[model samples]
Target: MATAQAAAGRTFTTDIPARLDRLPWSRWHWSIVIGLGTVWILDGLEVTVVGNIASRLSEPGSGLPISSGQVTGTAAALYVAGACVGALFWGRLTDRHGRKKLFMITLAVYLAATALTAVSFSAWWFFLFRFLTGFGIGGEYAAINSAIDELIPSSYRGRVDLVINGSFWIGAVGGSLLSIVALNTDLLPENVGWRLTFALGVVLGLVILLVRRSVPESPRWLLIRGRDREAEEIVASIEQKIEAEKGEPLPEPAGELVIRQRESTSFAEIAHTVFSAYRRRAVLGFSLFVGQAFLYNAITFGFGTILIKFYDIPAGDTGYYFAVIAAGNFVGPLLLGKLFDTVGRRVMISSTYLLSGVLLFGTAWLFSRGSLSAVTLTACWCVVLFFASAGASSAYLTVSEIFPMETRAMSIAFFYALGTAVGGISGPLVFADLTGSGVVGDTVLAFQIGAGLMCAAGLVAAFLAVKAERRSLEDIATPLSVEKAPTAEAVTE
Candidate 1:
């Protein structure tokens, strides 16, 4: 490998992007997926355990003196609040400091916060740690999504991203099953069971952190920051390992990107580039994220309350129902993910959002008429979320891929924070109160609101989603670090 020449305002051309995207799928790529992607599973477990345990936590013998409404509503909102703030805070750092460093730091933050949460002696203590835990997970979203998109080959980016994001439901499924064991008073005491869940999350996060240490920083990110020689070395190392695996020399890289390297991008520049330069995309991102956040928060946070209040199901039994829907959520992305790459982002995103919305409306109607049992209702949710999960997972993929490389982490953080703040914080509060009222009409109305927003987002995606599938990051949006002068391969639009 040749050394990258540099000047005061460093500018250079390198084939790092092409070198990464052109490599064949190998064990190394799987390592990246397992290392970075498993965090979502942990996230899913954290959320699902909280939801399933809301009833248990509200009981008299439970460790904390909190109501089911407070557990599901206030605590849930605080977690989201933490995530919103954390996404923006750590997201900025990820863009400035580099993906590898921020991801590792964020995971450590999560582990420590979760450990504290497991030892909470009061409601406030639990609430504070919930917020802190979300803070770490929120940073993981911006950092991991940016890294995954940068590292994965363009041909596989869409499906891989969808599966990774959807992996949150895998944790949800585990949480559901785990809650059954933990919440069984016959098996474990009430106070002890709830605390055990958080401890388990810390354990899983530790394993992910160990694997994540080996994952390299994004070469694209390194080159843009004037660390060209390090970037080349990383890519060269991967190529050698891959060729040895394939027993053949790799094909020549296709193109090069010339970057005027900078250590940091100002928030002002990132904001202008996203909202001003790509105004339509900005709207699309907000709509998609808000829609999914509201829909997921409404259902995930309130599933236990709804089952107990409306269906007379035992608190311990809710997990079985939730586990079914969680499976549906994961299956949606695994099944429909390929279409986003092959059939295109516009069709898959719009169709999944619209289809899921329609199904949810049907569920609301059936429930209003008292025409569904607990089993049937869970089935309905399973079907609706099958499509919704794919659409929601696609939302992350859209924001991460459609922005300039220089602003990737910040753009993801900005939209995720904005959308999640609006939808996530408010969704649980609203749903908790509505479902707690025990009025079928109130619950039905809540369902209608979530369904409406999802449909609206789908319509926005139909018109605004970019044709970003199977394209290099630079092709979708020009990097801010690129030279002002025209390059033969520079993507204008």
Candidate 2:
């Protein structure tokens, strides 16, 4: 463990990024994955539990005076809005302060908010805590994605990131099952079960926080902050650990990064790098995020309501159907994630988005015609989300990789906040209103909107997605600190 001292404003050349990238995958890597990736499960649980319990919350004896519409529409929108605000607020700090610090702080925010949410005695109280919880999760997105991508080897990065992001659905599946039990009066009282769900999220988060303490800071981040000695030590320690575990010496890292080390990147510089120098990538990131955000929010936030209103399914029983689709979502990324690395990002990303969009359009048409039952509709959702889930996960991968290292977290925050603001915030609100009308036509309209955006984004990805698989981060986009200096200090530790 080293601090950023005695290294600021220095110029140095080191192979920190390359060394980290060349090491073989080991148990050490799995530790990082477990420590950092489990937060998504908490998010998945939060979202799924809310969606599943929408009807129960709207009932007369649910402790809170919230309507189903308020739960799905107003509360959901506030949560997403908070996330957008939180991403912007915390993202800059993450880039300045380091990923480890921001992620730890953000998780604490989420835990505290969720714990308070469980004790809510009024609708406003519940809504306020939901937003606070989202604020924390939003910051987690920026910090974790940047750290995971920077730490993982280029060869394994695509699949690992996708699987980790997709693991959110595992929590969804868990929440869905938990909701069934929570909503069942025989198992637990309505007021008690729902509160317990939020409390459980806090417990899970505490476990993750304990594991996260051992997860190291990003060597790449340290290197750019002029902590070359610290960065070099971390990389060497990782190499030695991996070598000992694998019983072989790691291959020599092939390239050096010559950087003018600075303590932090300014907001103005980050904005220009993302929006000006990499303007095309900015467009691509926006398109991908909007497509996924709208599609997911519209469907997931309102799905239980769909089952209840259209099919007369009980609120407690809805979790069973949701679990099926949640499994499909997780499986899509787990199975297809490798193809992102092997077949190339453009083909896989575009194909998944386009295929899911086309499938959803068909599902919508069938639903409008009243040709499907609840069981058949859930099956259709499983098929559609199988691809959509993978496409959505890639949106994160695309944004995190295409930008320069200096702007990585902020770029993720900017596009995520922007796209989620446009799509995530509005999507749930629109879908809740549309579906709440109990008019088949209104629901169909919502479906078509999500489908069209996904299709449009796929077309954009066809032309704009980066082929970033198996490439070093520096090669993908040169760091802003990179420069040639005749008298540059070289630290080849």
Candidate 3:
């Protein structure tokens, strides 16, 4: 998302042609974000489905040993590893083979693997399926993001992108809801409840696929590949729609779309494009990836588990607490999600980290004392989740915006994968390591550490990042060229 972004933004005047309504979602551009946003939701769901059902997985006679907790956690790690690898393959593939085709591939891999995971009989089988599913997920960092970045208008990009990005929480809720009902039932064996949790992932994926199918090929990719005819066809459709809305001829396409050094770019060539060219992006992008993975992964994967086990919530009603926790998850991103756009990315990020850390510290105090009312505890926790999601959600879209088109996909694939390898892979282990030997081991202290990390990262990022009013996605991407960048990519929806 970071490396290959363009130095451009789409210009949309209120002069929206009346024909705008006639264009299908796919043709409009922002639809790409919507499409990928849905993918992010489903993939995120697959990643956590097993964790949400860890209680059931740990049940006796479920064919797993008492070590099922670690077993599933390890599987989550491996899934992230697969995503790291998959991103390497798919990011470039999208650039080379075109975003549309590779988008299809990632979607299918995730959708199919999710369904298969639902039926696995052994830990190894489950592990293998998750690992494979991670590959498709890896591509998502680039494919949907790149498609969306290239499609949407810049002014609306941050907010719209963040909102679409909010689907991850929506998926998180979906996973929790399924686990809540299915984990409590015998519609499948207790062992099979986890499977049903994963199998249920297919429904969202299918929806993503259907919506994505309506979205058209990337005009940017088409033009770059020298498929000018197809590119023009898409452009013509866009122009025709714009003209119709105006009841007149559309204004000339203003920005110059250049296809430089037309050779097929190898992985090394693609990588060199960033590390060799832009060091500022290298540091910023890596930070975004690592920070997000470290903080967000811990919160999502550990939140429900810790809420039930360490907090002493009864198992029968664990789902209810988990739901409360998930609601906290949704509540965070839903209301404050747009902070990235209105408040400026740096302010929002810094505020998110600082406030969330304070919330965590407060939570730590509450857990240590063990004297807080239930309502107080839940309210405080939910506040933390709100900032957490708002800040964290911005990371994904922000990462996508920071780099140029040439290295956008590659940079995103590299750092997100790197972050996943570092933070995403390590987060659960860190939680598992907490031991909670202290009074608030799993409950308050653990979350404090997580929130503190976000605060720290945000502080560093804020000081280093461009000020909010001055921030624009295109400005940071593609520094090698002396020529001025056009604008940030357009939003389609």
Clash count for candidate 2 is 0
> Tens-digit lDDT track for model 1 on 225-268?
76888888899999999999999999887877777887678888
| Model 2 bad stretches (over 4 Å) | 1-6, 484-493
Clashing pairs in 1: none
- Report each candidate's C-alpha RMSD, comma-separated, in the order given: 1.9, 3.1, 6.0
lDDT of 3 by residue, 342-446 (tens): 777778777776787777777778767776654566667667777776766666666576655555676668877887788888876666555323335555656
lDDT: worst 10-residue window of model 2: 484-493
Lowest summed lDDT across 10 adjacent residues in model 3 is found at 10-19
Supply every candidate's count of residue pairs whose N, Cα or C atoms clash at under 3 angstroms. Answer: 0, 0, 31
Query: Which candidate comes out best when scored by lDDT?
Result: 1
lDDT of 3 at 241: 61
Q: Give the TM-scores of the predictions, in the order they appear.
A: 0.97, 0.97, 0.84
Q: Which structure is stronger by TM-score: 2 or 3?
A: 2
Question: Model 2, residue 332: displacement in angstroms?
Answer: 0.5
lDDT of 1: 0.91
Q: How accurate is candidate 2 locally (lDDT)?
A: 0.90
